[model samples]
Each structure stands twice: as structure tokens, then as C-alpha cells.
Target: MVSTRVDELNSERHRFALGIFMAVVVAHWAEHLAQAVQIYVLGIPRPAAGGVLGSVLPWLVHSEALHYGYALVMLIGLVALRPGFVGRARTWWTAALVIQVWHHFEHLLLLGQVVAGANLAGRPVPTSVLQLAVPRVELHLFYNAVVFAPMVVAMILHRKPSADERALTRCQCARPVLV
Candidate 1:
């Protein structure tokens, strides 16, 4: 009976983790769908379209398959690292919203004003780098810090003293992988 109860608990944990992972995946794909509709159905230009129409969207869309592949790998890896956004649902969701808002503002502020031509992978890409200044970069960095503050707080709050001390020590030495 004890073994069965333990198994059931583990199953519940796994299901919760899977649900969180699925939410992230679904949000990203929904963003992609919005981008497609904006680009094709509305007949909007690439740069302008993404910023105005798809700016609030979450997916990291790439123009080519290679870009998409790389993004997918990174996304999966990041998702796997946490497995779930465990603990403090309100805090995590608030963090996510802040991050999303900051990201959209980044697009609008950075990419909106194009004054010079930029190059990418031997291709002459036109961008607004000249319009972006040091102040904008600083502001964006500050926004990023603020957005991540909740996660940091959560970790500090949830960490046990023994485990925390051990983690600190392990950082100075070689860390062990549970798997």
C-alpha cells in the first residue's frame, strides 16, 4: 500500500510537470500561428508585420528551417531543465507576463527605427541599429533584471539551508549529476 501511494504521488508530479511544459509549447505555437495569419492573410511586410501584429506573441519565429531548428533545440533544452514552472504559480505567471511585455517593448523600441543597413551571415540585412542608442540598451537590461527578480526571490525563499550551502560548495568544486 505504501509503495502504491508513492507511485501515485510520483505520477501526479510527472503529470503536473508535463502540463506546464505543454503550456509553454502551446503558447509558443499559438504565437507562430498568429504570425502566419498576419503575414499571409493580412498581407503585411515582414518587419512591420511581426512588430505590430505579432509583437505580443511568444514564439521565436525564424525565417528559415535552420533557424527554426536551432530555436526548437534551445527551447526544448530550457524547458527540460526546469521540467515545470514548479512552486508559486502566481509568481511564475506574473514573471512570464512581465517578460512578455518587456520583449514586445524591446521589439518596438529597438527594431522600430531603422536608419542604417545591417549585415547577417554574408547577407545585407536592413535594420535600425543606428537608431538604437546606449540608453535603450541600458533600459532593456534593467527591464530584464526586473523580470527575473521574481524567480530569484522564489529560489531564495524556497531553498533549504543545508541544500543551499551544499549547492554553494558544489559550485566551487565539481558538481554531480543525479542522472
Candidate 2:
């Protein structure tokens, strides 16, 4: 009884949840891309070249609360939706999840530094270890790319699973078998 309900939820309902999560992820990606273009292509200064939402809420770019909140959201979404994947999709998803865990930890560290009024490695601003070598904006872009790439691959594999993968799947998100 409970197993059937779980299967149903992982089918249609899981897909819906994944769709919403992907939308949010894409929006965040757009913001980062916009910020990058503004800085590199448009030659706009970082403080003035607010991204899409940043133009309206400029403070959001520098807000620890916003950064930490989004990191938490991504972490939660990855973990919650993970069970629906199987085989190769599960492998790719696990890779993304691991990277996101690290990414979330970095954000947590930055947020903590901001709240404590201290910067890491004696820098002027709160910084992740990677940010020590790469600029914050660029580092974040790289981080997002790595995380997003594996996740996208996982989603593709999930939608079109191999026979073995289909067998291993616990959800109905994969393409239906033809009679």
C-alpha cells in the first residue's frame, strides 16, 4: 500500500518537483550569466552592473542571507529529488549532490564570516578557499557550471533510461515502455 503510494509520488509528482527545482536553478544561472556579461562584455563595474533581479534589488548581490538561502535550497532540492533516479542517472546525480554539498559548505563559511565580522585568510571580504585563487564571481560561475552540468546529464539520463536502468528505477519518470 505505502510502496504503491511512494511509487506514484515519485512518478508524476516527482517530475513536477524536479521541474520547479530546475526552473529555480536556471533562474539563478541566468543571474550569474547576466552579472558576468555585465562585467566582462559591457565593461560595467561590479557594484553598478546589477544582474536581472539585482538591478531592482541591488543589495541582493551582496546579501549573505540571499546567498545562504539559495545554497540551502539547492542542497535540499538535490537530496529530496535524488531517490527518483536510477543507474547512470543516479551516479551523475550523486556527483552533483556531492559537489553541491561542498558548494553549500563554502556558502555557509562565507555567511558565517560575514555574520562574525571577519574575513577568511585575512582578506578584506569573506572568502571561500577557492576564492583565494579565483575571484568570487568567477569562482561561483565555475562552481555552478560544474554542479549544473552533472545535474543536467542526470536529468537527461533519467528521462531516457536503458533497459537495466528502467529495471532499477523506482519511479515512473522514465519513458514508458511500448507494448
Candidate 3:
């Protein structure tokens, strides 16, 4: 039953799965955008700008567990639905997955520091390697943008694949030429 369900997800439910995954990704992006607006447009102090949800629950923004959980979810979504894509779409999807892998590790690094009560390079807060060069907020925005770009490309290609790709795919995501 489990194997059959997995196959069904990749074949029949792939479109729905992709939609849900992209929705979650977009929501995360919106949160980052909101945070940026809070900092830059609203003139909120960097220490206090926690985006929309963060406004109500400030701890959510600061929680390493929340950030790491999101990274893990992104990675899992990419890996779980990969088999539904083919050819160029698959290649782009793989690219997103690879980048998300690194993103997940960065979050893991932050979570690890919090868990051990030790910050990188003696900083007060948990810091990722890239965070050494870039602040955490901007660094995460950059990471999400990179991952989301390839995901967009893959979705576009998956929906309107080349004829060759259409022949190779197992999912019902490809759209027919309307001309």
C-alpha cells in the first residue's frame, strides 16, 4: 500500500504536490519580503523587525528550530516530488534540490550552535559560515531566491515541456499546445 501510494503521488498527485510545495515556498518568501519591508520601509529596528508572523510571535523569527524545520521541509519537498519531472525540468529541479541541500546545512549549523550554547567565532548569536560575510536575514533571502529561481524554471518547463520531455514524463503536469 505504501509503495502504491508513493507511485500515485509521483504520477497522479504530482501536480497537487507541486502546487502545495510552491505555496509553502512562496509563503516563506513573503515572510522575508515582509521582514525586509519592516526594516527598510517601516524604519523598524533590525532587532525588532520580525515580519508578519514574527510580529505576533517574535520568538518564531528567532527560533532555530523553526528555521531548520523550514529548510528540512524544502529539502524533503524537492526530493519527494523529483521523480515526476523529466529532461530539462528534472535537471532544473535537481539544481534546486542541490542548493536546498546547502541551505538546509546552513540552518543545521545555526541549530547546532544554539543546541550547544556556542556561537560561531565567539559571536553572541548562532552564525552560519556565509553569515560571517553576510547578515543572517539577507543571507537567507539570497538563499531562498536562488533555490526558488530554479524551482520556477523547472515548474515552467514541467508544465510546458518539449515534445521529447512529454514522452518521457510520468506525471500529468504537461500542458498541451493550444495554438
Candidate 4:
């Protein structure tokens, strides 16, 4: 029963779901890029450097709830869409999934710190282990790029698979394999 439902999710009719997930991911990426520009190019302080949506809802950028929610969404999206890929694409997708899992863990760690009122490594605000080396804004940008890149590659490969890949694919994501 569950397998049937999962197969449905990976079907061509449900491509819209994948589209929506990618849209959300792209929007989040834009926000991070905008924030980076505000900081490095505009000389704005991190606290004041609200991105597009952040300008309207200034608290959004600093909200642990928002950060953690997005991380959770990304993780869920990756896992749910994974079965659609095959061969090389499946490998790339798995890579992205692994990275996203780590990214989710980092967010969870940060959320835990925020809840506990103690930052990692004695920082004033909640911080991830990597945040000790890179600022939160920058670290998140790096994470998003790494995760996004592989997912994009996977999507491209999924759409146009080789013979072996087409044979391996369970979903109709790629062109139909010829005899």
C-alpha cells in the first residue's frame, strides 16, 4: 500500500510536486544570496540585512522556527522524490540527500541550542559546529549551494537517462526505454 503511494509520488502526473519543491528551494536560495549581497556588497550588518521576504518580516531571518522548518522541508522533499531517480541520477540524488540530512542535523542542533538558551562553543546566539568557523549566513549559503547543485544534476540526468539508467528507473521520469 505504502509502496503504491510512493510510486504515485514519482509518477509523471505528480511532477508538479517536484516543481513545487524546486520552486521553494530556489526561492530560499535567492533569499540567502540576497542576504549575502546585503552583507558583503551593501555593507549592512547581519542583523539588519533582511532579504526580500525578510524586509517585510524582519524576524523571519532570525527565527529558529523558520530555519528549522525549511530544513525539515528540504529533507522531506529529497527523500520523497528520491525513488524517481535512477542509475547516475540516483547516485547524485543520494549524495544530495546525504548532504541535506547533515544540513537538517545542523539546523536541529541550532534549534536545540536556541531552546536551551546556550549557544554552541559559548557563542551568544545559537550556533552549529561549522558556524564556529563560518558565520551562520555564509555557512547556510554554502550548504544550500552544495545541496542544490547535486539535486539539479540529478534532475537533469533523470530526465534523459542512458540505457542502463532507463532500465533501472522505476518511475516514468525518463524517456521510455526501447527494446
Candidates in order, TM-scores: namely 0.32, 0.92, 0.97, 0.92
> Which order, best to worst by lDDT?
3, 2, 4, 1
Clash count for candidate 2 is 0
- How big is the positional error of residue 21 in model 4, measured in Å on the Cα after superposition? 0.9
lDDT of 3 by residue, 50-89 (tens): 9999999999999999999999999999988998999999
TM-score of 2: 0.92
lDDT of each: 0.40, 0.89, 0.93, 0.88
lDDT of 1 by residue, 37-96 (tens): 666688866554443324654233323333334334434423332322234533553564
Lowest summed lDDT across 10 adjacent residues in model 4 is found at 169-178
Q: Report the lDDT tens digits of candidate 4 across residue range 1-179.
A: 98888888887644677789999999999999999999999999989998889978998988997899999999999998887777898899999999999999999998998888988888888889898899888899999999999999988898899977777676666656567
Q: Per-residue lDDT tens digits of candidate 2, residues 34-123? A: 999999999999778768899898899989879999999999889878878888998999999999999999999999999999999899
10 residues in a row with least lDDT, candidate 3: 1-10
Model 4 clashing residue pairs (backbone): none
| Global lDDT of model 3 | 0.93
Backbone clash count, each prediction separately: 1, 0, 0, 0
